[model samples]
Target: MSSVAKVVRSARGLLLRGSFKQAATQLRADISTGPQQQHGTFYEFRTYDIKPDHLSAFLKLTDDNIQLRTAHSELVGYWTVEHGGLNQVFHIWKYDSYAQRTAVRAALAKDHDWMSKYISKMMPMLNSQDSEVNYLVPWCKLGKPPKQGVYELVSFQMKPGGPAVWGPAFQAAINTHDSPGYAQLIGVFHSEFGDLNKVNVVWWYESPDKRAEMRHRAHGDARVVAAVRESVTYLVSQNNKLLIPTAFSPLN
Candidate 1:
């Protein structure tokens, strides 16, 4: 078993015995020994639902004008929904800190070209928009695939009370699939905005068919099945989206 699983199992036994103090101490020790979470970086995930008739135009406009806005910050990736949603575009932006994000937003508002050439034309093409700020889960870092391919964004709506309640099992499950090379784990993020206790897992595959094959193989692996079984006890609900990278996406 992985150290994470070991700690979680040991801690759970203490809790079952009503040894809350010992369980807390065990968790503290495990945390100290684990990889430190990167708290300095912030990622903004933005989703826009475009009018069906305007989707093509929106893509062209973004391809031509995204540089103006990206000048103020880093564009991690940009993708169009393929399976889970219709007429939706999703993108991620990286900022060194919250203050950096504030500065970027401020600069965008003042960029005349961005306002006139993009946002002005872009807003009317949308039916709705949403954004979430998130941090990379401690055990994960942004990763790249061997080459451009499709990406899957799995959103987990974990039960309440935050990571303190479900982080260990969640991490263990992720580590199981990731460490085994079952699929390319790109990133794992925990929401800091929108619904609380939300976790997003990004995976890359050569094709949808390959994703299916790997998933089947993974399910057959006892380790993965066991890890998933343990993790789901804390899950409330989950959904996923298959995304195709835009031409200018860094991940592509």
Candidate 2:
């Protein structure tokens, strides 16, 4: 067998032995052994509810003054909800560590340009806001699509035990669709803050119609159905949002 096949076999054996944690531990160890991604990176998901009438102004202000805020930290992506939520903007920020995030927050508070040009003008346009910190799942890396396209954010609230309990099957279900060459799997993130035991799966497609076609194709596949059936047992609730990348979004 090829080296890749051997690795897959080993991973399957570990999972069969009910060692999801052990499998992840070993994979992480192997990653640390090579020149790979840093382990402590965090992604903060921020959602702001914009006043309906001020939505356009909010987007414009953000497009114009976002650089000041981004100078403190990295912006992964910024988007507006097209469905599942209205008049809301969502953005992801990347930080190397919690300390880095704290420092960025402090710096943002002090930056006159960010506060005055962006925050001050942008504040009144919001109804409320929310944030959640998440870490990329051990077995996957963030992915880019074939080209710029619409994205979907699917949030799954799982039962109490966190990734240790649901992660294997959940990842397996995601992989079934991915391996079948369906919609692009952007990333799978496990919540680190806010609501516990939540996982977010991000996907990209050429368009809404393409996404529907891909979903239909996946549902027709027996492997996809089986994997989803297993994963669904751990799911408590789920929600999804269709996102359109903002003009200045890194992922746009």
Candidate 3:
């Protein structure tokens, strides 16, 4: 867990003592200091649409050359969309700040190994690339699960009002997931740039069988059912992707 997560947990304990205002004040104060003041670490979520016939080839190229990129920074997670966007490879890269991202790209630009052996050849294989930057929500942070597991990324596109419109209900929904141990919450991130109302929560499972069993049991869970019913009213659309971690992915 990150420092932000620790602070949130501490504040949450105070709320039980009729100190909600104090907790909120402390949380606000925390957010305004250090990295939180400037949005802490950032994530680059990039989706690459590949040519149908070129998908396999493109993936091969990616697996083969990803080291060139990871050498400069971190590849948080990577996957191909299975349920929502077709033939798309979605991945997240982490950086300390925008300045680090810029410096890393500059390093890649100067590396002949990356330019000649990969970039030039890989560009034509992609149809389009969409990118966005996001920040982790205060109560959520990056996670590291076992290296071998099934991963799921659930993205919620909320109504225009953002977190304020649905935070309480959504938080209630998250609480239910915790008690049942339905899945391990890898992280929850909210869009900072690009489409503004998007939020994504990533989860991991021990196995496919485990995930199926959990969902089947969760379907009958009343607390989860109730919280989800209330949260849907503030959502525009939702997407889920079952991801298989790449060999080089940090989150794997």
Clashing pairs in 3: none
Best by lDDT: 1
TM-score of candidate 3 versus the correct structure, residues matched by position: 0.80
Q: Which ranges of candidate 3 are over 4 A from the true structure?
A: 1-39
lDDT string, candidate 3, 116-199, tens digits? 989998999989999999888777768778657878888899887556556666767877886579888888888988888898
Candidate 1 per-residue lDDT, tens place, 11-77, comes to 9999999999999998877655534454689889999999999999999999999889878899999
lDDT for model 3? 0.82
Judged by lDDT against the true structure, how good is candidate 1? Answer: 0.90
As for lDDT, the candidate ahead, 1 or 2, is 1
**Best prediction by TM-score:** 1
- TM-score to native of every candidate shown: 0.86, 0.85, 0.80
Question: Which lDDT tens digits does candidate 2 get at residues 135-172?
Answer: 89888898887788999999999988556556668888
**Candidates ranked by lDDT:** 1, 2, 3
lDDT head-to-head 2 vs 3, winner: 2
Model 2: which residue pairs collide? none
Error of 1 at 92 (Å): 0.5
Error of 2 at 25 (Å): 19
For model 1, give the 10-residue run with minimal summed lDDT. 30-39
